[model samples]
Target: MDRFRDRQQAGERLAERLVALGYGREPQVLVFALPRGGVLVAHPIAQRLGAPLDVWVVRKLGVPGHEELALGAIAAGGGRVLNEEVIRGLGIPAEAIAQVEARETQELLRRERFYRGERPPPELGGKVVLLVDDGLATGATMKAAIAAARAQRPARLVVAVPVAPPEALREMEALADTVVCLKAPPDFRAVGLWYERFPQVSDEEVLYLLRVS
Candidate 1:
């Protein structure tokens, strides 16, 4: 059975788990949502915990013909993580890496501008940074986000998701100080399969959440 009705319900239920874990009581807490769908999953959590919410843009660098297969990812403030094994196995060239990075860098900047206007990104130093995403797949995007959050030197770094495959959750634990995945079903496949009403989150909704929530 699907565990969540939608992103909002997932966020609410996830927040309850976080609160039980004592994150809701922590000082210097900041919720950073991986934008678009993640923002939806983050909104209610941030609201429930009274933590300030912000967006972190991470772009996936997909393998050239198989665009869905991520070779690497780029995060805000020039943070990046590359999959050396994938690159070597695919024999991807350095030039291709540079090209993909450059393109994603531009897209990252565009998202920041569109989302925040003239406002600068929130500071992460000395804070308990909660990285929220709807779910984890290959985890490339969240890995880049973890690197980016680490660059800012947060006091603590955590990753929270509604559902994820057990293997990916285990791998993410090495990068994040705490990983709170509500569901880690052994038969995991796509993230959407665990939600009853999964749908594409629009840019307008992301902007609205930032402004209103």
Candidate 2:
């Protein structure tokens, strides 16, 4: 089982792969990290690719009782993606889904303001946009991010992550023009399990990386 020492190491490895694939050679490239974990994973990629780094804030709408189980996700620019399978399988009602979306939407907006401050989002039209995340489990959040990026009419939308389950990777491939995942273990259970040290990223760290990049 391949394991990453930390998010930084994972980001370095992903950056190497991106460079090998002829990325980072162009000026019309923009990298969007899904904070606060994705910010660290994306920093190295942005640095190596010489791409301007930014955050695409998205909030996972967890099920009311089971907060870890993602019901859907809402992103900045009013992009939302719902898991119909999960909602129908759990017999969740519209009222419940609406409530969850409402709560997460507020947090998403708050994070966008807090992280971005007065800086306007970059122009994605006709640019190669890379959406980076630490890892993916259900991929709901990345889906929302992709939807938001697609609305902006990027020339190409790429989904990059260090590790993800094969099923989740397949789902992302359908949404993005290209998917760059370092590891897709079939028996993958959780994103944290593949890492030696997976800690919750703080807002301060996210702000620092954004400022530096």
Candidate 3:
């Protein structure tokens, strides 16, 4: 709603909702945020909940000709997702997928270095993990992140975002243990639209946030 000036405000609102929903307790409630927008959001929530804040890097694999359209996604440690419909519709060969994944993997590593430096990933096993993002569209990257988290055997996996398309929000529920989206508009064009100040978050900014936290 208009209550959120940006992701930070949205996260504060979301944290209040979470506390109301009964995730107010101890060590099990961990917040894992995707950079760079999610970091801003997660910071407030982590402080409010006394939860450990961390990052989970995942990148989208965009389809040829429609770079905005996700063909699938990939996360660290080789976790991957493929959109069968996009692949078939675009006639994207298996080799093509491999090529995209390969490139994206490089970008993923770059992001991880930019955002994480030498910090290790937090323990996820047996924890009630809440994954945060600014928003979602195809949800391919978030799906991959969920898969990666599942490997760590979290007690529960929750996907939370400030906004998303209604259809994408539904799809996210199938992957995570819970979905906590603030808005799911039918006319959801992009994540930026929901915010008044959706500035481009540079890699420098990402690194700065990581450093501060």
- Record all residue pairs in model 2 with backbone atoms less than 3 Å apart, i.e. clashing: none
Candidate 1: tens digits of C-alpha lDDT, residues 85-193: 9999999999998988888899899988998899888888999999999999989999999998899999999999999999999989999999998999999989999
Candidate 2 lDDT by residue in tens digits, 54-145: 99999999998999898899899878998889999999999999999888888888888999998899989999999999999999999999
Instruction: Find the candidate with the highest lDDT and give its number.
Output: 2
In every candidate, how many clashes are there? 0, 0, 0
TM-score of each: 0.97, 0.98, 0.92
Go through the candidates in order and give each one's C-alpha lDDT: 0.92, 0.93, 0.83
Deviation from native of the Cα of residue 107 in model 1, angstroms: 0.7
Supply the TM-score for candidate 2. Answer: 0.98
Runs with alpha carbons beyond 4 Å of true place in candidate 1? none
Cα lDDT of candidate 3 equals 0.83
Worst 10 residues of 3 by lDDT: 204-213
